[model samples]
Target: MPHQPIPPPHRTYARAMRAEATKPENLLWQALRNRQLEGFKFKRQVPLDGYILDFVCFEARLIVEVDGGQHSGAIGDAVRDRHFEAQGFRTLRFWNDEVEKELDAVCRAILHEAEGRIG
Candidate 1:
């Protein structure tokens, strides 16, 4: 197996970040938290492989990122994606606007991707 980055020892920081979830993240979390979507359990602000994932479904090996404008074409994101991919995890990123404007569609897409991975 390829070497993967390990999660940093920053539980305090991660916990603080989780407390201040962005609007888009809060919105999506309403749908994803507590296995609300198709019974697929999702966790918020999870620390994994040296990154704080916005949302994670461990069973599906899926990491969902609700990105703001700053994330567009970000090289760092590419590197993060590759790191998770190396660990057999798939990442799905959605813009803040997309999540805010088309929440239903985004949820559908997330559900589809998660189901595909699960099945």
Candidate 2:
């Protein structure tokens, strides 16, 4: 009998987060899923480097975060960004309200960034 390894804690948490996504996350996911954003593949609620990223496109090395009011001026975010940057990934953050109100603009920015990285 072979034993299976348990999934990491961050992976489990990320799965739960994907299942119960916030409104803004949902909105963004709709735009990013199925390579809809300029043929770039995006995965939501992905676990990476001990953190659960809201969305990540490995090919483009981009991570998108949809933040709420609680995240305003969060110092911890800077540390996380630096860590990801060191891994050669750029992080793009948008407020929840910004996503809800300016979904097209948000998608455009994401596409632009992803294109830049991919190219």
Candidate 3:
């Protein structure tokens, strides 16, 4: 059965996402785009149902979020994770520092996690 389309995000939310996605996306996106990592494709700044995700690996059902200072010590992250979990998508979060300071490590972690999801 085809899934019904969820309502579009509010206009302000969509615009903010576009601006943030272009301006603040982590380095991981560069590596993920164009199938640079093990031929896995990723979409950046995507809308999936009610929320917009930083990066989504659709085939693997993984959502990667690059969080900034605001998310630090903020419990809302867990709540958001639960929402994605309920929808059958695994959420991976990396702080901006992790991506900027240890990009190679982040890339490896993503690869490892994705591998586990495969047969």
TM-score of each: 0.92, 0.92, 0.82
What is the Cα-based lDDT of residue 72 in candidate 2? 91
The global Cα lDDT (0 to 1) of model 2 is: 0.91
Clashes of each: 1, 0, 0
**Best lDDT among the predictions, by candidate number:** 2
- How should the candidates be ordered by lDDT, best one leading? 2, 1, 3
Task: Give each model's whole-structure lDDT.
Answer: 0.89, 0.91, 0.76
Looking at model 2, the pairs that clash are none
* Candidate 3, pairs of clashing residues: none
TM-score winner, 1 or 2: 2
Candidate 2 lands at a TM-score of 0.92
Candidate 1: where is the Cα deviation over 4 Å?
A: 1-9
Model 1 accuracy (lDDT, Cα) = 0.89
What CA RMSD would you report for each candidate? 2.1, 4.6, 2.6
